[model samples]
Target chain A: MTATLAIGPYNQSERPALEESFNAHVVADPSEAAGMDPAARSTIKAIAYKGHLPFGGAEMDLFPNLGLVANYGVGYDAIDVDAANARNIRVTNTPDVLNDDVADLAIAMWISQGREMRQAEAWVRDGKWASDGAYRLNRKVSGGKVGIMGMGRIGRDIADRLAAFKTDVHYHARSEKQTPGWTYHADPVALANAVDFLFVALVGGSATEKYVSKEVIAALGKDGVVINISRGSTIDEDALLDALEIGAIAGAGLDVFVGEPDLNPRFLALDNVVLQPHQGSGTVETRAAMAKLQRDNVAAHLAGGDLLTPVN
Target chain B: MTATLAIGPYNQSERPALEESFNAHVVADPSEAAGMDPAARSTIKAIAYKGHLPFGGAEMDLFPNLGLVANYGVGYDAIDVDAANARNIRVTNTPDVLNDDVADLAIAMWISQGREMRQAEAWVRDGKWASDGAYRLNRKVSGGKVGIMGMGRIGRDIADRLAAFKTDVHYHARSEKQTPGWTYHADPVALANAVDFLFVALVGGSATEKYVSKEVIAALGKDGVVINISRGSTIDEDALLDALEIGAIAGAGLDVFVGEPDLNPRFLALDNVVLQPHQGSGTVETRAAMAKLQRDNVAAHLAGGDLLTPVN
Candidate 1:
């Protein structure tokens, strides 16, 4: 069995691992194929790309050549999954493996932003302490309210972590859940109104798109915070900006966005928000685990077994 | 019997609860005496200040009329204890009442900073989804090393929180402690080298001052984080900057500073550090509890019983 592999801009451990598992010829870079002649391009049977795909830009044409394009993460919005589905090409994503890391990050943001840890450290780094007064305290976290949107694996994981802190857990999902110790609300607004901190863990696409809008933002009145770990489309940027500008909400911690990297200019101007390059499941251990799963997924697809995380 | 009373900056519910226990007058603004005329200054016999002393800037003439000064919180740096002692004035501070809140904040900072929660949330709020690609995974918290500079009550509380997380706990103190599940090192440099995260919970006075210096920072090396819930003097500012700039130490979460509100400018530039406004015991419950303790301390002193938290 002949296997042709197109390599994406990955962190490099994938190449040797996949090669060891199958007779694979690796295309080291996906961009190099743009200049390759038709005969050269015809030689490759399938490809995998990593790192980041430029937003609102052309989908790298490498997907058409592959029988399976196994993404190393849960979010595959960057890849044209619909286009691949139209062509009957199999699109796979590695999920459930990165839940702990994501949940850890979520809880961390809630505490850092709420407690003003960044600002606290600045005082020591500055020389004013040699001449001045006592340290000022920030907000509280232990008995605060925590609301999770889209209560899947990562959301549930975050709830479990919060349990140790004794925080009250509330979640908003499409339908009510029978999960104990969880107060479920069918609407996001009610959840927003009740929670001091709101988390987004819902999936992307039409159903969850624009779910956390102006109404939800309004519900999360003053001193409320929004944390989004799902797709950027889950939140309405303009609505968030309006809430932030007027101080209707305390602050926000976001991991996903509708149009990232070239993020909304409004977020950059606000000091109340914590910013990062979209790297939620971007840990070394988790990424390696994700890559292994992607490999298993591709091999299974080839072996006539069902895909681990099928898009359909 | 002729009686005199002194209370710290506590609210009505906290300090006034001792009305029947002793003759106490709880002043609303103890710092206002700084600007008073001679007659008004002479009228008040005692005071209670909470972070109200313009310590390093303008010293208030609080001693001439004051027979005793009772501080609200554990730290009495705001009160001129030497000056009060010279005038035969007794100084008292509420110490043990604040251990739990400080400890809770320390653990919160540890988990939040380690996981990079702030950066993750910012990615989502910025609308990175429509314009960009994948989510980045952050660092983990469980099984990491947690070092303590001061193995006092708050430090012990932090150690207690880590038990559930399964973190390896290490502490550096002047003397060895019999704390369970804890490894104590007599040398700060040795402890810094052995741990990934260090918590500062030492005393505020002379002996423990400037304890964490360039040598200790270097010992920790890159990827090490220090959290200061103790006095700002525990860490040497210049050394911390050098460590942070060169990546010798990964980051720090500071609640206390050497100069305070007039914090150092260097910390403002770094992305790795987390800052707070010196609020270890700043929660509503903790503050209220501290206020009640302060009232009780003053009442006990007036009643001729044992002082709650007296300076030896």
Candidate 2:
């Protein structure tokens, strides 16, 4: 009688909660739905999914009775929303709950890049501090101009944190929004030109694919650094790598990358960049909250009520 | 005739300015004074001092005509002010110039420790994210209560930055001063007990030696963390190392340490701490500002005008 199908990898805490709450049929991935009995697969009214693999119209055909896809993370780029809309299926994502964690990571990377936290740690741990007199001085971060590529919830949160550090906030969005004395640029290149740091926080999907193009990255001068907590596809990967390699841009503080967890090998060799493993929202508290929100959406769908955070 | 003697290590930029401004005689250490001709040592009226080696009453007595000790850094714990006062020797420190950089390091460490930034970076670089799955989740940092163990310029700066992150700020100072709705605790132990994080920004000197006593560190329960960007004398090293070893507290984000550059071997072994090589005020812009300030003080002293930032 189970109507819920929990797909993709779930943490220890999440697995138990998913099993107990929904009497869910669990699988490691979306493709494994084919392995389920024909009768059971058709019974799935809602799916609790977490991963970056695609969920398109063909995948939706596997579940004839599928009504909702409740994603466990904030970004639902993996879920083809147009496909879901065409199939009359609802989509829900866990947002706002993860804004603080992502924003914290963005700010952390920004400061770490300027202060050289990784190299500093390595110097201390490897006994270089004892052998060498003092670590080399790097650039100062505070009292600089910063541009946020997106002025969404997560972008605004990062801007607020940087504002405390006395950075001048500028941004480029589709249109101007009300803000406290922050400059807005309609063109991404102009926004990049205006600031010493360009932080990418745009949404994922085709319309915004390669949104941070070569021109935008090139506009950031040799002293400029880029920090990205958004999707990898939002950036022109080759352009970024080229810029980082040749010192076209000063550096990058990246939590996401193209084809990640198997990112560009060039990134591994670079010393100028601060690379994080796409952990913008990877906090115990925030993850649990996201899981709960996803489950709540499934419960609401099963109960024939409206989805809590509906995308379509 | 050269009236100034530049002591300890000076970066390339600082060295030329120090030499040009005062026609200063240079020595690697104060002990090298013994090697100088007696007449030259006696004629040194001002010393542009750097490094953490003590400038006690005995060291002060070496340069018989010494009138001022212009320190390169803000924390003048290395200079024996009481001894300077006894000899009518003035002391000047480059203060306020490096506060933002120090405060930024404190916040950077605070966020880095919580986010497991070191591990996250390693996960990507080592190809573990592809081999294994996602990096393990860590605790959230923002929207929590944070405590400041001092209310000095740097302490206030750190609190202001944390406030923008939506953290409830609580502080310990000699007495409460004007703050933006931050709760004050007169007792250091109470401050430790009240918040999830305690940032030590106390000044260094015998008066505040081991100010963050064993009792105060013990008060921070298992979930609490400590961040120190101040002088190494503020905390008992043995107590901190012991607590870290036994997991008495969660972790520490430390920049300064006792006998730093030659820190306790125990700190290198501990995985719970984010160890930095005492680079709190080591940014290029800030360091240049500090060097300029120190040189300005020396120039003023030589000209028989008011010292820029005199201590005694």
**In the order shown, what is each candidate's alpha-carbon RMSD?**
6.3, 1.1
Q: Give a tens-digit lDDT track for model 1, residues A1-312.
A: 344464565555777777777666565454555555555555544455454453112333532455666676787765676667665667777788888667766766676676565554444455444455333545677667889988887788777767666678899877877676689988888999899899888877666779888899899899899877777888987999889888999998776655656677787778777665556666777788888888888788777789888765
How accurate locally, in lDDT, is each candidate? 0.69, 0.92
Per-residue lDDT tens digits for candidate 1, residues B1-312, read 113334334444655554544545444454544555555556555455555443322333543555456677787766666766656666778886677668767776776666654454444555553445444545666667888887777777677766545578899887998888589898999999999998888877656778888788888889799888888887898899888888888888777777666667787788777676777887666777777776666667655677777763
Give the CA lDDT, 0 to 100, for residue A129 in model 2. 96
How well is each residue in A57-128 modelled by candidate 2, as lDDT tens digits? 988889999999999888899999999999999999998999999999999899999999999999999999
Best by DockQ: 2
What are the per-residue Cα lDDT tens digits for candidate 2 across B1-312?
A: 689999989989989988888899888888886678888989899999998988889998888999999999989999999999999999999989999999999998999999999988998898999999799999899999899998999999999999999999999999998999999999999999899899999999998889999998899978889999998889988998888899999999999989888999998888889999999999999999999999999999889999989887
Off by over 4 Å in 2: none
Model 2 clash tally, residue pairs: 0
The 10-residue segment of model 2 chain B with minimum total lDDT is B29-38
